[model samples]
Target chain A: MLKKTALHDAHAALGAKLVDFAGWEMPVQYRSALDEHHAVRTACGMFDVSHMQAVDFSGARTADFLRHLLANDVAKLSAPGGARYTCLLNPEGGVIDDLIVTRRDGDAFRSVVNAGTADKDIAWFQTHAAAYGVTVKQRTDLGILAVQGPQARTLVVPHLPAALRERAFALKPFTAAWEGEWYVSRTGYTGEDGFELVLPHADIVALWNALLADGAMPCGLGARDSLRLEAGMNLYGNDMDETVSPLECGLGWTVAWVPEDRAFIGRAALEKQRASPPRRMVAVMLDGRGVLRAHMPVRDAAQRDVGQLSSGGFAPTLKQSIGFARVDAQASAPFEVEIRGRWLPLKQVKAPFVRNGKALV
Target chain B: MSNVPADLKYVKSHEWVRKLADGTLVIGVTDHAQDALGDVVFVETPAAGRKLAAEESCAVVESVKAASDIYAPVAGTVLEANAALADKPELLNDAPYGEGWLWKMRADDIAAVDRLLDAAGYEAVLAAG
Candidate 1:
């Protein structure tokens, strides 16, 4: 049986096309995906992301525990509301999952991880947290909604409580504020200005409806995927997994190499791999005909195999096919992607193909 | 709930065929098929003059989520493929039957088009699914 989010009924009521995604019955599109994509880029749109799991860490040793468990330095988050994006890696330096850990109040931090990796991540946390004296609380009672776009705050702030309205409106990117039971974070995966609200599951449907009534269109996973891809953001399973490291996935910046004395989980293997990085992730834009899709082989000038696409799709904003590929670390721009027996040229860019309703290509 | 014109003939594969005044058969995917596919992005129309066998895959229609093969309802020789779709594939989603026609073909047996299912039968196929 597939799991359903708190807003599942609301999605059905809106005539959404539901699909089985990562063991959850989630809305793929409400009306038209292209229209929804435009809504986010031009105006305001919202997504029901309740399937993503949030693990709360509290107790005196919480900060110390996260310092050792994650690749990024949690100690850098001195402010109470600061959020850091990092990867949870295994001992061998492979990314188990990438998540955002936010420092909420004193000794309390919450990390939201991928829906598909929730069970495994919880297990990994429990097994490793035995010595830290931290409380691992899986927040199943909460539902998350991401409202994004240029006018997202203007559209969503009015719906919040009066006291929270100003705080949420004033929130800086990557920071969070708690208003009673609602946790509002100025963060999102779409690479647009947005707020991710985590509230009680019982209140989700009302909030969804209120947002819809207030001109926030209900977008589904299709638009979500395209928006994230256009932003050059990595999708967990598509871009990286247990076998791929953060360095190879263009997430080297997320790893904190500072506090050299502090021993992180994957530090040793990562230290070894950092010296001789084998594969490097690059942004690819298809220059010829045909859509670039995952697993497509990337060949060099001499038709020598260089790499393969990790996440590929049609960028709705650009009206062109774009993807991320794991090519040889020495590989440069002007490569070819083998599509349906044809060697088509691809233009490599410095990622972030689109941001804030503008095309960077 | 999809639009199924009574004058057209359809196949189980979701393609619809209509006989033109010149006896050439015009083919396109049904509205339901396009709706299921969602926001057609790329189309691979069959080449003109290619001979096709009944139920053979002739063209490809791709959406962001998936790619589906459009099959020939009857044996025919391709007359002309819709050239506009090479640039604007979303025409299929906007107008699946009218301007979105994939290709026109001269049927080997002109009467073979009648052997395909009618609107009611096509609706039944969608209903069963």
Candidate 2:
């Protein structure tokens, strides 16, 4: 059975088309994906991302444990209320998940992970944290809502507590703050200025309704996927998997290579792969009459099957089909995607096909 | 939801066919199909005068979310296709049963239309699913 969020009834009442996504019955779209996608790019949108797992790590060894657990050094989260974008990797240097770790205090931190990989992430943390005497607490009592877009901050600021609003307003990118019972972080998956609010599950329904009343459009997974894709964000299962390495999945920037002395779980394997990364991730925009879609074959100039599209869709802002593909690193620009036995011309380009209501492609 | 005209026939795969006075068949995706697909972005239709077999993929309808194949309801020769869909594909979502007609075919066997579900039969299929 698919689990429903607190906004289930609200979504149904608004005529949302609900689908079972990663075990959660969530809204895919209310009116149209294009409208919702445009709303997030131009104004403000809210998403009920409560299905994602949030874990609380406390005690003296919290920092030390994360240092050994993540590919990116957690020591960089030195200041309280700071946050770092990092990747949890398998022993073979393949990314298990990419997440944000927030420093709530000296010895307390919170990490939010992907919804589909929550169970596996918790298991990996529990198994590895045992040796370091660290406690991993899965905070299921909390609900997360991401309010994103250009006017996001302005829409949410009025509802925040006065003391919290000032501190949150001063938050830099990737930073977080704890005000009363709410944890507000200036971070989001969509490429927009927004906040991810973590509060008690009981408080979420009211807060979500208020956000809607405050001119924040309630978007669904359809818009969420398009916005993240146009922003060059990677989907866990689509872009990378257990067999794919971080270096090959457009996530090399998330790996911290400095302080050569501190060895994390996947350092050795990554060092070996870094010298000769196998496959490389590239972004492509369809130049002709075809929509790029996942599993479509990518061909080089010689019509050689070089790779396949991993994540793709019509970029609302660009008004074109764009996608990410794992291809031969030596492959050059201007490839072709085989859609229904026809080769459609495509141009390899730097990602972020659209951002902040503008087209970058 | 717009009305599904009683005179038209529908296929289980969501294609709608209207029989013309000249015995040709006009084909398009149903309203529910367009709604489920969200916003149409690009559409690929078969060339005029092409022969097709029943259930053959004759066109492609792509939305912002995914792409779906529009199948032929009966063996026939393509008479004409909507050229406007290439520039304004969202017409399929806006007026699926009217201006959104994808193609017209010279029906090879007129009896094939009887094999298709009527409005009520198609409605029952949707309900059963």
- Give the number of the best model, judged by DockQ: 2
- Stretches > 4 Å off in candidate 2: B1-3, B21-24, B109-115
Query: Mind giving the per-residue lDDT tens digits that candidate 2 earns over B6-78?
Result: 8999999999999989898999999889987888999999999999999999899988777899999999999
| lDDT for position B55 in model 1 | 92
Runs in model 1 with CA error above 4 Å?
none
Estimate the lDDT of model 2: 0.88
Output DockQ, candidate 2: 0.78
Q: Candidate 1 residues A1-361, lDDT tens each?
A: 9999999999999999999999999999998888899999999999999999888999899999999999999999999889999999999999999999999998999999999999999999998788988889899999999999998888888788788898888899999988777889999988799899999997777888988988898999999999999998999998999888899999999999998977999999899989768899999899755688899999888778999999888888888899999998887667999877688998988789999999999
Residue range B1-129, candidate 1, lDDT tens digits: 899999999999999999989899999999999999998889999999999999998788879887788999999899999999999898999998999999999999988988889999999998899
- RMSD per prediction, one decimal? 1.5, 1.9
Model 1: lDDT equals: 0.91
lDDT agreement with native, every candidate: 0.91, 0.88
- The model with the greatest TM-score is 1
